[model samples]
Target: MTTQATLTPAKELAAKNRARFPNESAEYRQARNALLAEEIELRRHIERVAERRRQLPPGGEVTKDYRFEGENGPVALADLFGDKDTLIIYSYMFGPEREKPCPMCTSLMASWEGKVPDIEQRVALAMVARSPIERLVAAKKARGWRQLKVYSDSDGSFTRDYVSADDADVPAYTVFTRRDGTIRHFWSAEMSSEMADPGQDPRDAPDPDPLWTLLDTTPEGRGANWYPKLEYPSAG
Candidate 1:
């Protein structure tokens, strides 16, 4: 059996895949075949990028022993890792100045809440916010996020240093690694609106949020006017 490294070209593999619907037109089938070719290339590119990311050299070592308020009490950056050497921190946009959390961030976190147990098996995961611990807890409860461990960056040290320098009401995904008693920054999502293509939203390739992915399969394709909301007024 040929492994992926020795497999046929993506286009060839894509062309070999055949499917037909009851009443689909010939033109539709032809267009779909072309789309499938591109999809196969996209999948290959994603794997290549992931391989490069894993090969990256060590990132900058963390200097500040940032403190955070967890559910139980105060905890340091090192403590968040527990027994795991890697930690993935998601900066929640629920800062003190904001009356409510960012809807986009909330939407992503809601999906992550269900995957926490599976995700934590390899690396530690924590959701950090600039709000006080109590406020963070309240928001978590309100959203019914039971699995995600929430923490408060009460001093804004970690947020400012790793997330944003100005404490912007923005969400960020960052990863850190610990080795030989030294913790170092690993990687973070740096894609921004400035990097977006014309007519496309600035988002990471193969977005972490499953919402957009699921929508991409539909006819509307993640409609521009629609967005996830914290709550929708119930129909009276």
Candidate 2:
């Protein structure tokens, strides 16, 4: 454990940064250095939050054997873990009533599709929905996702219990851990629209979506009105 007093100050480290661009102005450099210091502090804060999450006391034990329909056949919550002890389930907003899935959810899933294999190296990952498995599989095929595993919470039991009691079509990210024959609820991204700042949208800290992260680095940032779409006019 590195002590705070012994660690180099973020501002000092930022000052030592030698990165320079061609024809950069002094005012820009000064402002950028200050921003860099803040970024460094933000990184440290993120790590601290992660460590605190890791130290959290054991979560509630999962008693119900939630069932889901996978691409091939039926599977239980425990079976989702596969060979890993930790399982991450992303419940996207794809229910029976909607003709198309939620654009935001689809965007996030698209970003995660390619990284599924890399992510599974440490924990099992599954994309789940309340629609039928066939519909979910069709969506997966349409998206051209090769590695991401899709499943259907056919009965909406899992969604009602963990995601929303009203069973509203919403996206949720939940993690469960299996150890010593016991599966327990783990950390979840609980931040919602209600918790967001006045101008910002609901999002988790150290956001899992790379799109937003990338946009945040730009001058426009993530615009208030703009959002992802299932099909773009320019995509063709």
What are the lDDT figures for the candidates, one per model? 0.90, 0.92
| Candidate with the greatest TM-score versus the true structure | 2
Task: Write candidate 1's Cα lDDT for 93-114 as tens digits.
Answer: 8999989889998999999988
TM-score of each: 0.94, 0.96
Work out how many backbone clashes candidate 2 has: 0
Q: Residue-wise lDDT of candidate 2 within 1-236, one digit each (tens)?
A: 33354667899999999999999999999999999999999988887888788888889999998999999899999999999999999999989999988999999999998888899999999999999999998988999988989999999899999999999998899999999989999888899889999988889888898999999999999999999999877865
| Stretch of 10 with least lDDT, candidate 2 | 1-10
C-alpha lDDT of residue 77 in model 1:
95
Off by over 4 Å in 2: 1-5, 234-236
Give me the displacement of residue 97 in model 1, in angstroms.
Answer: 0.9
Prediction 2 global C-alpha lDDT = 0.92
| lDDT of predicted model 1 | 0.90
